[model samples]
Target chain A: MDTHAAYKSRWLPWVLLLPSFVILLVFLYYPTIETFVLSLFQVAFLGLSKSFVGLENYKILFTDPDYRQIFKNTVVFAFFVVIFSMAVGLALSVLANQRVTGWRIYRLLLIWPYALSPAVAGVIFLFMFNPQSGIVNYLLEISLGVAPDWLTNPTLAMALLVFVAVWKNVGYNVVFYIAGLQNLPGEVLEAALIDGATPWQRFWRVTFPLLSPMTFFLLIINTIYAFFEAFPFVDLLTKGGPSNATNILIFNIYRDGFEYYKTGMAAAQSVILFIAVVFLTILQFRLGEGRVHYGG
Target chain B: MKRLVTVIGLSALLGFAFAAEKVQITFWHAFGGGRTAFIQRAVEDFNYTHPGIEVKVEYKGSYRDTLNAAILAAKQGNAPHIVQIFEVGSQLAIDSGIFVPIQDFVPAGLEFQLDDYIKPVANYYRIGGKFNSIPWNSSNPILYYNKDIFKKAGLDPNNPPKTYNEVVQACEKIIASKAAPKCITWPLHSWFVEQWIAEQGALLANNENGRAARATDVYINSEAMKRIMKWWKGLYDKGYYAYTGKPEDWDGANQLFVSKQAAMEITSTSDVTFMQNASFENGFELGTGFLPTADGVERNGTVVGGASLWLTKGHPQKEQEAALTFLLWFTNTENMVRWHKGTGYFPVLNTSVKVLEWQHWFERNPAYRAAFDQLLQSKANRATQGALIGPFPEVRTIIENMIQEIFQGKDLAKALAEADAKADQALKRYNASVKK
Candidate 1:
């Protein structure tokens, strides 16, 4: 008996893949290649005037202190958002996994923020966190007797962004973790229980190891989301200001390209961002996947 | 069923015939919120009267976004017939080589005299004695204060601050009396800095504020700039000035004032109507004053702070002609008065000013007169004509960031020096990139 399953015609596979291939080519590959090409040239008048500048744009990017600060800011932002969102999500998922009354409603409420676009979330949070008139400051002043400037202070602004980002993404991580919890083998948990393991030990030794695959998956997803999807939040809320404290790579790209009309420089920055994210993802897969216990 | 099909086909054919006869042109603009509706209504009115031409107007985000979109569209050979560009983008628009100077069509004749436009506004857009763009919605900064707060602070409500020192003194009184949490606020913007620099009769860049030739240098560290920064920084240090901590946050500054968080604000003259309504709703008597100059300065006035209309290249002759007609009509005396009534923007035409004077419009609404007086009193000089830099948008951000750094306790001299260096570099790069 042949183990191989084959299509009747080779054209069928090509036909089936054509739509997605065309989309990827048009939207992704073509722009990526064009950006790389444009990165090597000095562009003006929306590329009506141009000169080949080799790696001059890249040289400027790497040497600029502002760009370096932006890189550091992005890394710190992504790290906080990923770590906190996943940690809170896991803790909530573990608690919510219990067979409690109205568990469905609890889960539904927890997942609602994931439905809002990042821009909308930014607008809502911007209003709530306004230093002078916001409800957040009002409550804080009344309760704590000290209202910190949430937007003007650099550290507070970064913290606020991280906090809002985590809040926005925690629901998404919870959805995944809840599914991962449902798939956990009951026998192993029961065995751990019978062996006199504490609740914490059960989570750490058995359940955690079993959920490594899901955690690893969410790690990659969260990292990418924190890197790229935070543009709208930055634009709507901070505009990457308060002394460039919140300026991230994506918002900087937009400011340079669209606002400043430095298209070549923005393209160079894009290429750098693209490389950084790709390398980061690849690094994660290489070091992370080997430890993920997929078989349970 | 056959009769219904015939009726539908006949109507569709008629619709196509009617559309084919109309000379349709697209106009892209940067006005949002209430202004978008006003422009749409104006376009509808224009379309109703001019059955031969159809003007399709689009609100394309902010000033920066609209300019970028226009350039990108023009690159793809689909440029809008008319693009509204803000004051800062004027140099870039002229450098883009994408627009046909409105002056080229001047000989075709406008019913209204071009000289009737306000001098400062006309001066700003008239590059090398040629009208590069049609000035529209011109404005300058004016001081807005709450009379209730002034009265509470034991300061005269009719007499607002007239100089930087006086503003500071008034703020001190207001804060000391607990009339407001903060004394004053303004959008931490570069435009105000430009205005202050102009007020001192100082140029912002070399070569006559970049009017005589392409600007290759910026005077960010000039004495005028340092003086302005020193005064501004002093306010922030004294805890008298409040801001939303975001750059160019005009609406945020307005919010602080209307909510009584701040006693006074310096914002665009274009906000007169909004300020009136806000004062009424908030139950405060509003007072408008000239933008305060530095103490002991002669007060050479402010540059225009609003957008203008530019005609794009590559449109058909008929469309270009139609766009020119629409622009002239939009800026005509009657429409100028209507625009001034609808929004607080200056009626750029002298005839419109006469009409308003004839109607005693200023007597009924004195706040609108403050801005117009400020503009009319501005000296005709290089400084008051405003700076022209190819990379002005970038230079503006750099200055805003520098000011933010200063607010965060950066050394004023060091920050200004660094900003100067950066602005000059930007100018050099911009000059290199764009061919004259």
Candidate 2:
């Protein structure tokens, strides 16, 4: 027998990979490279005119106070949306995992918001938290006699966005958690329980470590969701207003490019966003690898 | 092979059944809901009246989105024959070099008179002393108030506030009456600010509101703006104003008015029909008035708020002619009446106004008439001509942001200065790019 098993035809593997490679190159790589190239030029006349203006767009990004504020807002938006959603998601998943009656229904209800697109989610939250007319404020006034202005106040608006982002994604994380929990070895858990370990201790010592891989995977996916997929939410709900308080990176690019017709600036902003997301995912993998346990 | 032949044969047969030699044309607009129905009616009527040409209409999201799509389409050589661009995009449309001036199609197979168009409606679309696009649907901002709230607040329902100072006094009274939590509701739209600046006989940007020449600087830090901003801030500070803080929340303001959360509101005249429905549903009598001016200055008037139709280049001459003919008929006195009565937009032609006057339409529909009067009373000045610039939409966002900051307690003068600088820079960049 040969030491290595090989494909019947080496060309078959390349042929099999060709479809995916073509799709990725056309859909992803081409646009990404185009953005990088366009960022170095001044594009106008509806993309008919292009002039090389190296580093000028980036210089404006670095110099303009509005751009600076928007960039900071993006970082803050991504940081809060990812960290808080994952934490809440973990908590919800654990609660949903309990052996209780109606838990399945509860889980189903928790996952409902995940079915909606970012625009729909934004609309749902917008109607729910509307200051004067929303049910949330109505109930708040009925109970406490005070309803905080949900959209007008900058802090509250950002917090509301984070809440909605988490609300929409928590179910996704919960599903993974449930799968991870189901795969936990019964013998190990029984051994821990028979040793008189408390329920919380069992979860921390055995269950949590076993679920680390799922958590690590989710961290990467949720970060991308918060960074790029939240454009429609911002556009539909806040439109990057109340002093540009909720103007995150993606929506800012849309407003600058599509709405304002500043192609070069938008391309530059896209590159910056790409770099930030890449750096963030890489940082997470490096710092988080030690904590992920691959149990035997 | 048999199936492929059958499919090709069926498609050719279908093509012969319709639109074979009709010179099909596409019209792009941003209207939905009720307005979309209006467009469909016109399209049906046109198609029925002229069997030689067929036109299809597509709604492309909103105004900004539609304009972006149209521009990109032009670049790809697939542009539509007709596009409805909002009045603010006039300059960009002209600079686009993508349209054959509808003016070039003058004497467009009809007894069309350019002067018959309402002055303010024509003023915004006229470039280089020629109408670049046909003014289609037009609107102006007007003050809308709750008559019952005004009456309760000791302000006469028949007589609304007419000056800036009067408005403040009325708002104070309304708040003191405790009928609503706030005296008035305001949307953070830069259009209103632009209108107010014009009402005070002051231009929003230098170079004759960007009409005489390309604007190099924005006059946002003027005394009028500071005074207006200071007054606006005072209302919020005094708890006499309600703000939702979403920049384009026109519907939100309407809700405020209908729910009695605010006594007064300012919005496009195109909203009159919707306001009537709200009034019927909410059990409040809606009163209308001209937008109040700064205390001592005469109210010059307002710029048009609706959109217009342009005959795009690159379309076949026959298609462009058909599109222009559709527009000419679309704005004729009869269709104008239908459009104005149906949509609450201004009747773009004076002949339509005469017909409405003769029909006692104004008396029957007083709120609509208030807007008509507001436009007729407008002074032909640069301020009222409206700002025409390539980067107008961005400058508007900057002004909207500065306004929001001011409302959030940013220093008024500093915010104005910052907004002015941002707007000027946007204009400079835009001018530089299109300089060739």
Candidate 3:
């Protein structure tokens, strides 16, 4: 990989790679280390009155029922957001891949929601589904004669948060799915058609197997997105309650560290969340390793 | 030639040193929306009058946002010279050690007495024997109602509810009359709960509300709280109340009131002007009164509900003096009256109230008198003095969540007990973090 002329010193590659390593050390390793140290100490504003607590913060967090409930909430929220967004994205991509008039416009429109920031997505969904003056409630009342409070009812609130997260993320997933669909070889599908196979049969036996790599890649990305990026919707919408109904881990961490100013507790929550995301990512990679088929 | 040049250089340097200059200081506040105009005008007036010092005001979003910003800025050694922190955050601000007490920062030549501040409003900010921050734009909760809705419901608008039981009776009448879909609606705010507790002369936290010392216990499960929570849950169960969901959704409740979905609401006295305008614009009669207290008990007053001006430390003494000078100037009798008239907050100075009364200001605007009387008539007891726990805002959130759970049909006693234990844990954690 080295393109430069041979150098006398063995330290040349190390010197060239030092900048990125240092950047990682400062921004990533530094904060991680600080979080571990902070998780063991009770501290507040400007690091004043830091006292060593010997993992007391973690013990309290683990022992608390509310914190455990929050962990379960995070896992359930991530699972729903990832699976729903990916499934909807795949279905939409299949529809958009057809050679029809205005298909280009449809594809462009399908990919547009990916451009919205999570906070903006939150606000748009909030206004659109707002219990008071939202058009969705207005329409539901007019047509169905019932308007459920989408942001307040515990089950509906969680469902709406997941729905909005999926809606915001499906566009990004669509772009990848469309690429995967286009990259499939035409010969296999054509042969399947001649062998008296149905289109559904062709898709399952021929097309889906070839699309596994994209699916595998998207699984990891979607899991991470749902775990980390989806909390903004919860933050802007419910603030983790109508009684802690939507208290996802990350939102709780923010409440702990920023809102409540319990830095030690927040840091411990962060460390736990980091482990969760890492574990989820590793699980996806291991589970998908054999199933992700390479090109023929 | 060398001697002449040297003398000219030294003379120029000495003249520059002797010249008077205005020390510019930044004041960060949390007022926004229509309130921005009033504060901006005040800053302009201060700048125009006090040419020796310049006061620049920045609206730093909500009280929490401003406090968080100030905390981070203090860490970076560049906090604003003055920060307006809401009353709930006072204890946290005090413990942050980022402030120079108002007593120490008052200009030496000025004869300003902290005693001049209104008793209840000033009481919340004074810890020990000293005022940590100057009370600015203080408010108390009051009952606001749609008089037209009352008349429609065959209830006398002039005779509003004076107790929680009476509130239920009034709400029942309103509901039966079908004048409003709900008899009452309010944001699920813990502030109102705190006020209700204080109305019974109950401490929110032990250790004299953290005034005598750091509070390790909260009175969330006390008899007073139990009674209040029972009534609150009754309101929900009897279909007499509707909640706007979030504890901070005060604006939504305001919409419900003005839109005629709710007949009555309890809100900050500072919102009196806004509610009045909404009432006028929406074509409803606005009636104001002291917030309802429990019947059969002598009603104590509510705690103060607004921000205070804090002079930040780590600045040059001259800047501190200039900031304090502007703080004094900005809160003088005339300015306080101007602020009280502009916003429905208290004048915060006895002299200012005296001036307004003499000027027939309250006479012309009779609506202002309700809050004025509510706060001024308060007895200076520990309950009305307001709690000084370091984690008050977070504890308030726990109380809010408990109320939400109760409204959702959770067992009131269990929720309150659990919430109290959780709040005590939070307070203990906060106390440990800040202990030296």
Candidate maximizing lDDT: 1
Candidate 2 Cα deviation (angstroms), residue A240: 1.0
Q: Model 2 segments beyond 4 Å from truth?
A: A1-10, B1-18, B108-111
After superposition, the stretches of candidate 1 with alpha carbons farther than 4 Å from their true spots are: A1-6, B1-15
Across residues A52-121, which tens digit of lDDT does each residue of candidate 3 receive?
8888999988899999989889988999998999999999998999999999999999999899888898
Candidate 2, residues A85-153: lDDT per residue as tens digits?
A: 888888888888888999989889888888878787888788888787789989999999998888888
Per-residue lDDT tens digits for candidate 2, residues B1-436, read 9999999999999989876878788999999998998989988998899898888999998998899889989988899988999988888888888888878776634645578887877777777798888888888889999999888888889999888788889988888888677787768888889898888889887788888898888888899898788888888788787766577888888888888889999888989999999998999999999987788777788877788888888877777777777778777889998999998988888898899989999999899988989998888888888888788899899988898899788887788888988888889999888875
User: Top TM-score: which candidate number?
Assistant: 1
- Model 3 spans with C-alpha error above 4 angstroms: A1-3, A6-22, B1-20
> B367, model 1: CA deviation in Å?
1.0
TM-score of each model, in listed order: 0.97, 0.96, 0.93
lDDT of 1: 0.91
Per-prediction DockQ comes to 0.70, 0.68, 0.56
**Cα lDDT of all candidates, in order?**
0.91, 0.86, 0.86
- lDDT tens digits, residue span B306-408, model 3: 8899988888878888898888888888999888887898999889989998999877887788888999878899999988888887898898889878878
Model 1 per-residue lDDT tens digits across residues B75-154: 99999999999988889998889998888786444634677887998899899888889989889999999999999999
Model 1 chain A: lowest-lDDT 10 consecutive positions: A1-10
